[model samples]
Target: MPELPEVEVVRRGLDAHVTGRTITAVEVLNLRAVRRHEPGPADFAGRLAGRSVVAASRRGKYLWLELDGAEAIIAHLGMSGQMLVQPEGVADEKHLRVRVRFADGGPELRFVDQRTFGGLALADMVEAAGAAVPAPVAHIARDPMDPAFDPDAAVTALRRKRTGVKRALLDQTLVSGVGNIYADESLWRTKLHWARPTEKLTRAQAGELLSAATEVMTEALAAGGTSFDALYVNVNGQSGYFERSLAVYGQEGKPCRRCGAEIRRDPFMNRSSYSCPRCQPMPRNPHV
Candidate 1:
């Protein structure tokens, strides 16, 4: 799944390419592409026909296109979803699910998803965290990169949880944006084991963890986000290079960049967690 950095990169690209453009036509090639709209594809295409895209916005992993009315087009870029901008006469991508043409008749925006797990929906705008966001994303907390993000409040919420520190970090309600990859990187940077209890962490330690998460994500964003495969790409279909700089995630049996200890992977929530045993010593009473 695309994380905050990847979503933010797509948002930036949409803002640059599609903002201020009016939708002249919308072709829903697959019903599953707009399954979240509930009213079906016809209603979905009808509602978006003439609306002008005011801006492209995002919260955490969610991306949306702000329309003229108090409504937005929410894009769910699930595991293998993509939003690609292509020239008008170019051949359509094999997995193209939705093609949006603009009044200007220039390049068109395409939604291509090989896995079909992603979709588009029209949502009403609602206030969330002192800003207007699609109603579906109202419950998601502001990310570390958000201008109004409160690090202190996030730290307080993180420590209030009884879960493991990494689990707490992955909680979108506490601190939006940090996913499995970034969480492991952040924990590695803070020298905190994934199973360390959140309540056992001092306020300083919690703050440092959040700070490291912010720092690492900022760097990842600069690198266009951590793409391990071709599935994750920018609007221009460019893959990120941050995966080359990863320290622990998927680095099983590799030497830790900081301490020379071999990195290890452990089962975690049906996935996996990576860490350096020497630097991030297991807690006396690990939560997992």
Candidate 2:
């Protein structure tokens, strides 16, 4: 799945290429593409036909195009989903699900999803924290990179969760945008095990963990986000180079940069968790 950095990178791309362009036509090539738009493809295309994209905004892993009215086109890129801006003459990708052409006859925006788990929705706008976000994303907490992300408030919310710190970090209500990959990296940077309880974390450690998440993701964004496969790319189909800098995630049995101990992978919530056993040891006394 595309994480916060990847989504933010795509948001910036949309701001550059799609913002200010009026939607000349919307072709829903697959019904699954607009499955979230309860009103269906006809209504979805009707709503966006003449609307000009005001801005491209994102909160956590969610991205939306702010239209002229109280409506926006929202999107969530599940695993293998991508948003690409290409010239109209370009060949249609095998997974091209939705295409939005512009009146200016410039580049068109395409939504491609190989797995079909990701979809678009035409949602009414709702104000949350004074930001006009699509209704579905109104509840997602601000991310670490968000200027308004209150570290103190996030710590308070996280401590109240009574869950593993990594689980708490993954909780969108407590703190948005920290996915599995970044969570491992952040915990590795903070030298905290994934199983550590959120309540057991000292205030300093909690703050440091959040800051580490911000640091690593900021670097990933600078590198255009960590791309392990061609499925994850920018609007121009450019791949990121941050995967080369990853320390823990997907580095199982590899030497840890700081401790020289081999990195280990463990099953976590049906997925996997990577950590350095020497650096981020499991808690001796776990919270009940």
Q: Report lDDT per candidate.
A: 0.93, 0.91
Best model per lDDT:
1
Q: Please, what is the TM-score per model?
A: 0.96, 0.97
Per residue, candidate 2 scores C-alpha lDDT tens digits across 1-288 of 489999898899999999999998999999998999998999999878989999899999989998998889999988778999999999999999999999999999999999998999999999888877899998999999888889999988888888788889999988898789999999999999998988789889999999999999999999889887688888778888889999999999999999899999988889998999999998976442
Error of 2 at 135 (Å): 0.6
Off by more than 4 A, model 1: none
TM-score for candidate 1, please give it. Answer: 0.96
Local error of candidate 2 at residue 54 (angstroms): 0.8
lDDT digits (tens) for residues 1-288 of candidate 1: 588899899999999999999998999999999999989999999989989999999888889999998999999888788999999988988999999999999899999999998899999999876799999889999999999999899999999999999999999988888889999999999999999999999999999999999999999999999897689899999999999999999999999999999999999999999999999999999998
